[model samples]
Target: MRIGITSPVVTAVPGVHSPWERGAGIEELGAVAEAADRLGFHHLTCSEHVAVPADVAEQRGGTYWDPLATFGYLAARTRHIRFATQVLVLGYHHPLAVAKRYGTLDRISGGRLVLGLGVGSLEEEFQLLGAAFEGRGAVADDALAALRASLSRREPAHHGEHFDYAGFVVEPHAVQERVPLWIGGRTPRSLRRAVAHGDGWVPFGLPLDRLREMVGAASLPEGFEVVLSAGRPLDPSGDSDGTAKALRGVSEAGATLVSVSLAAESAGHYLEQLEALTRIADAVAAEEGAA
Candidate 1:
């Protein structure tokens, strides 16, 4: 399995975020990214939320680094590690805007971008952004279709029920002939959408057993990725056996890409965990090779 991080301090979700993250900024973030990049980690994520409702801020993470800015900075700092937007709410931006802004990012990063998109559920935030709240799933489907046609093309055109465009040139478009798209959600419909419209599925908040059954039953295409996370933070430095076992379980549950959060109280501790995890992964690979 390819290992990645749901990067620290990028999105401070309640109960999940560490206390030290409240004070951490880009310098600390850069160090962690640089270490992961050097360690051969596959990807790192930043989530997107334009704004959260005051009442729901504590429930949904109030802190989100806009993916574009965060990834643009981190991309320059890291060479091999890919940048994944854990999700960008599909209804919030037009397909062309995503194509242009993220396309520039792809060009800048040397084609190291993965677009993870979702049909968002925050009704208040949707209204706040003046996005159409109803029938968003259909809108997202159309948007995905448009994105597929336009992501790498300079002069792209698409005609669909909800979105249509032609005669527009997107300069410095995505360098990859096909940029990876990962759909996000925890439901069956989300899985279907990923199969129908995306390259991978990034499912959150599902139990491991449920995840196993869902992925096992789906008619996934060849090389379709199931990117999954552990139920809780892992302590690779302090608890290598447990961390390794948890990572193994994630793979057994059918994750082609495994996203991990570390048990750390501070910036230094988090970097320690990254190195520890890499050592453990190397050890496991060595043993498997010997077998």
Candidate 2:
């Protein structure tokens, strides 16, 4: 299975993020991006949250780096590693807007963009954005359809239940003929949505057994990627065997791509873990090659 960095410093979750991330800025983030690009990590992810509620911020990780700005900078710095949104809340923006903006980004990045989208769960955020909270899932479904019809086309057009547009010209549309779309959620319905409207499913907050059951039950199409997490942050620098086992276990759990999280205490320490994990990944690949 291909491995991608879960990406640090971009979102400083209270318990999961390193303490050093609180003070780090784009410089540090860029450094990590450059290193990740050079080290052969398949992709680097950044999630979106315009504003998190103060009450939920503590638990949900208040500091969400804007994926567009972050990816734009990282794109300029990196050569090949893809930029994934981990998820951009679909209810927050118009499909054509997404197509236009990310299409420009795809053009700039030479088509190294993996669009991750979600229907969004926070009702308050939906209200804050003046977006429809009721029947949002259905709207999101339509939006996904519109997006599918729109992305990568200059004169894109679509007619859906909630959204209908035509004759709009989007210059510098996505470079890739078909940009990869990954739906994000942690439920069976989310899996179905991904199957119907996206290229992959990225579920979070589920145990390995639950994930395995859901994946086994689903009718995933050919080339439909299931991206499972590498579980807890891996301490490959301290426990190489444990790290290797966790990585392999994620692959065995039916993941076509694994989101590898590294445990570290500081920025420097994080880079060390990144390097260590890369070495472990390389060794794993070599071992598989020899076998």
Best candidate per lDDT, number? 1
lDDT, each prediction: 0.92, 0.90
Q: Tens-digit lDDT track for model 2 on 15-133?
A: 77877788989998888889889988889999988889998997997888889989999999999999998999899999999999999999999999999999899999999999999
Off by over 4 Å in 1: 286-291
Give all candidate RMSDs, comma-separated: 1.2, 1.3
Q: Candidate 1, clashing residue pairs?
A: none
> For model 1, what is the error of residue 85's alpha carbon versus the real structure, in angstroms, after optimal superposition?
0.5
TM-score of each model, paired residue for residue: 0.97, 0.97
TM-score of 2: 0.97
State the local distance difference test value for candidate 2: 0.90
Question: What is the C-alpha local distance difference test score of candidate 1?
Answer: 0.92
Error of 2 at 190 (Å): 0.8
